[model samples]
Target: MFNLAAKPFDYLIVGAGFAGAVLAERLAAGSGKRVLLVDRRPHIGGNAYDYYNDAGILVHRYGPHIFHTNAERIWKYLSRFTTWRPYEHRVLANINSKLLPIPINLTTINTLYKLNLSSEGMQVFLAQRAEEPETIRTAKDVVLAAVGRDLYEKFFEGYTRKQWGVDPSKLDKSVTARIPTRTNTDDRYFGDTYQAMPKCGYTRLFENMLDHPNIKVMVNTDYREIVKSFRHDRLIYTGPVDEFFDYRFGRLPYRSLSFRHVTLDRPQFQPTAVVNYPSTDVPYTRITEYKYLTGQTHDQTSISYETPCDEGDPYYPVPNPENAVLYKKYETLAAKTPGVWFAGRLATYRYYNMDQVVAQSLALYSQLSELDGSLAQDERTKQSIVA
Candidate 1:
């Protein structure tokens, strides 16, 4: 047996979230390398962590993480650990005392305008109102090109302002482009080929993934606390990129969220999984009912109210010209740093869905494996590596 105290660990993974957990499994089980996975939180699943509340209801601690993916390989990879429960996410936008399907679908438009129209008619109606932008450069531009100002104001403007702490016109097009407008009445939040959640919850899925003998886990301990004492050949960093470099190029802007969780003594609280409050009348951007996402039959329901703010744990990277330029500086610096690889949303300063994060970590592992010749060329890859 390999003694943990006698020799250096092969990989020291920071953050036991999706990026770190998936990569740690790949490195330890696939390559037979000793891995150390550490998280600042007292759990292994990171932000996707879920647990049973006082009422015995399963609730996501941070927010709802509904798994959806177009990549078949990714679905297959995660399926190895736990069985899945089919789940299709749906959202509603509360507008002017009306609850309508979001993504501005046909049902949403008809309900808002009180008109009966077919899919083709809906397309024509949108085309008649949408203004052709001279150049689509900003979030407001994208919104106006798809739907007119009236719809934009009702469904997007106030929410964007509250969520990002800025007007839509000042943000990057990628911000609004993430949300799709449908001509049809399909109200599903994501149109991926695979949509499901772990049968036992994300925490259990993570437990199965990190059960390898070669992988060790430490929680409630920041990497900085144990990094100096622990000897590791390579490092996988999944934290904020700016902090790693000590904000030398100045702090990159990020939007954080404040979540308020409550377990109500009722069978259900909302009609659907999530309801978006685009109006500025409310402080929160959205409210999520975990029972809908998890499909748990419980007398008491658990929900989370999300308030986006400038403070708290960074949840979203603010996308704009200035922030992009700042992130590039950190990226360049990371490339030069030896034996360290940055992965995940915060580390790369990009907003990625849970599936995308998993795909990225898998791709990174492949690159490392092929380039390092099964880690025989570890000394060389350590110096020139850029992930």
Candidate 2:
């Protein structure tokens, strides 16, 4: 047991999200170190937070977070905190008054063109239409190389523009590469080996993970102020890297989102969990139904319409050459800054899923453990020399 009154906390973690929580838990349990975990938000779980609505239906406050990963170690690590509710995510894109499977699968092509295209026929059609660039540069090249101009214009262009607040041509190839074009009829959004939701909720899983005696949590507390008020040996920052360095080089661009949540008397809002609107007229990119994700049954259903914006809460880091250059400046600065380690999506300025964030946190913990062990050994050697 740790005596918080006697010993100061060894580490002070900035965000109470997956990165902060996972690192805090590991440091506290593994090294027997006291940790002070803080978040500016009133609650934990960061973007993955979910709660029950007035209708008694579980709804993700910040759009939807579907947990999907192929990493066995990541799966096993997270499984310790929460039981799994096996879920395979499916998404549909509303194009030309018709809903088609996203990722431009065989079904998506057949449905959109009103043609019976087999797997082989679909490949041939895509190849004939595809305009492969000599050197693929941007997000535009990725989609154009795979599905061609027509399908890219219809399904990706407007949606990408609306979602990122920029044209796909301006964004990095990795942005569109995240979504793959498939020849098979597999309608599932992600081809991850393990796909599931936490049985109780993401919040519950977080609560379980942070229940250690050595860890102290402070919600609605800013780390900046806490650093001024208290003393800590090390810092684990999961906030924006640019902000951490006070935008030394420049403010790295980030795409934010605004969600309009509505609870309807109807049992279901959409056909599936998420429906993407690829048309420019729609204004919003996608509408997500929570029950499909939570597997919750209720008389009334809750849904949220996601509208991308320039400012709200930073949801996605804008991936582009200019932003990459700016982030590199901050990355160099972070490396020079001692006793402070950065992790997670915002800190690293990368688009990472839930499991990826957890995996990253675990990896960071291992590195910290090694560093701590070396420091302890040096201290012991110094004390022996003094003796």
Choose the strongest candidate by lDDT.
Answer: 1
Q: Please give, for residues 1-387, the per-residue lDDT of candidate 2 as tens digits.
A: 545567778999999989999999999888898899999999999998999878888889999999999999999988989999999999999988898999779998888888998899998999999999998999999999998999999999999999998989999999999998889899999999999999999999999999999898899998888786667899999999999988888888888999999999999888999999989998899999999998988889999999999987788899999999889989998999999999999999999888889889999999999998999999999999999
Number of the top-ranking candidate, with TM-score as the measure:
2
**TM-score attained by model 2:** 0.98
- Report the CA-based lDDT of candidate 2 relative to the real structure: 0.92
Model 2 CA deviation exceeding 4 Å by range: 1-4
Residues 244-318, candidate 1, lDDT per residue (tens digit)? 999998998989889999988889898999999999999999999998988899888989999999988888899
Worst 10 residues of 1 by lDDT: 371-380
Ten residues in sequence with the least summed lDDT for candidate 2: 1-10
Task: List the candidates' TM-scores in order.
Answer: 0.96, 0.98
Which pairs of residues clash in candidate 1, taking residues 3 or more apart in a chain or in different chains?
Answer: none
Global lDDT of each model? 0.93, 0.92
Error of 2 at 107 (Å): 0.9
